[model samples]
Target: MGTLDEIKAALINLDIPQVQCKIHQGLAEGLSPSAILEKSLIAGMNTIGSRFKEGDFFMPEVLVAAKAMHTGLDILKPLLTAVENRVKGTVAIGTIKGDLHDIGKNLVIMMLEGAGFEVVDLGVDVPPDKFITAIETHHPRVVGLSVLLTSVMPQLQTTIQQLEPYRRELYIVIGGAPITQQYADKIGADGYAPDAASAVDKVRELIARN
Candidate 1:
């Protein structure tokens, strides 16, 4: 198999060490960092995500696969030029204000990064002003909000309200255990993802719409 294919398989198997070794080997063989990232790591993550959505894989599987992908990325990141890394659109993501939960948010960030987007993770319990600050500073095309608490739904609403005045026509996507499409619509969010895998697809769709 080709080096890229081997890397993809290693990622799917969650073989972190193997993935790292193959990435280095590929580099030694004169493979471009961009080629390794785009053709191998991205492809593997996409497959794992699809399988998770189909019930063919679960969280543990996805987590391990994501870890392996990250391991490979660590090797390639420094080799990539600024221009290449900036090819994908930027994204700012966080758990809504008053919500301490972050597992979901972190997963979404990982998937976003794996898909090539530059992710600015604001961590958990992010206030409306923080979101606004990130948007102003980063000028991301997409903003992802995650809230796992029912009480924090209002916080999400408040965040959206705050963003409206400073908005540059950016796409706002919401997700969490309690978040639904109806809730997203009520809060004026542009989209809602039920899970991390779907978040990647939703963000891609949002990007396409613009």
Candidate 2:
């Protein structure tokens, strides 16, 4: 495999040490931080995401792969901080109240951070008031809402309504197994991502349009 693909493979196999070594080698070989991130780490996680959706992989596999990806990210994050590498944007994300699942939300965080967006994770079981507070305090370019249960989907609308005062200033994106594009549109959300990989693309596209 090519060096970049090797990074992806290491993450797929959940090989953290290999991921660390490969990422360092990529840097030593003069590859840009963003290139390693987008082409390797994030791309690898995209594969993991597909496997997860297909049931070839489960939560344990995804969690371990996320750890492997982070091993590489830990090494490269400092380089991305260089003045020449300005952050692409900022995001605040969390699961709505009554939903305790956070594995998907954490995956999105790694992917967003890898893609060079400064992400502020609002954690699981977050109330609409907390999301409102996050927007007011962080002044993020986008806010993401995650819901794992269809029963709690109403909280998504409630959270969006609470943030309506800042609607013109920040974009709101939603996701989770229970969240559909139609539901997103129904709630008047600015965007909806089907998975973590697409979340990166969606966030970037939304930011670019504004």
Candidate 3:
């Protein structure tokens, strides 16, 4: 297999050391940082997300793979310095009020950053006004809402509804263990991601549509 393929495999296996090493190899071989990101790190994370959706991979494996992706990203990031800060697009993300879970939020942020989007993190327990403030401040192309609790689901809807004034101005994407496409549709969100890898995909799609 090729060095790029090796990079992808090391990431899927969650081999942090190998991932970093392969990234170095890719750079030495003259592979562009964007090529390394799309072909290796994002590609591997996409497979992990598919497995998680199919119930073949669990949270521990997903988190480990995320770590491996970060290892590779740490190497590629500096090389990508010129375009690293949102040449792709900007996204404002946060966990809704009363929901403190961030593992899912953090994973998505990692993937977004790796994909070359500048993320304005709103942090956890964020209110609707904070969302609006971020929208006004960053003028992000997408706004992401993460909800980990079934009870806090209403807050997600409230946040979305409260942002109706900005609906025409930006796209909204929602994700978390408790979040689903159905819930997203019901709450009038623009997109839904089932896993961290797909979160990047979803944002890409949103950017295209926007």
For candidate 3, what is the total of clashing residue pairs? 0
Q: TM-score per candidate, in order?
A: 0.70, 0.92, 0.84
Model 2 TM-score?
A: 0.92
Quantify all predictions' global Cα lDDT against the true fold. 0.84, 0.89, 0.87
Of models 2 and 3, which has the larger TM-score? 2
- Top lDDT model: 2
Of 1 and 2, the candidate ranking higher by TM-score: 2
lDDT of 1 by residue, 1-210 (tens): 999999999988888899999999999999988788778887788788678879999989978887787777677765673535564788899998888988668767866775678899999989999999999999989999999889778888888988997566589999988888998888789999987768988999999986
* Regions more than 4 Å wrong, model 3: 47-62, 81-86
**Candidate 2 lDDT, tens digit per residue, 133-202?**
8888989999999999989999889889999999888999999988889999999999999888899999
Name the lDDT value of residue 175 in candidate 2. Answer: 94
> Per-residue lDDT tens digits of candidate 3, residues 1-210?
998999999988888999988888888998889888888888888888789889999989988987887777788776686656436888999999999988779878977887778899999999999999999999999999999899999998889889999989799999998877887898789999888778888899878874
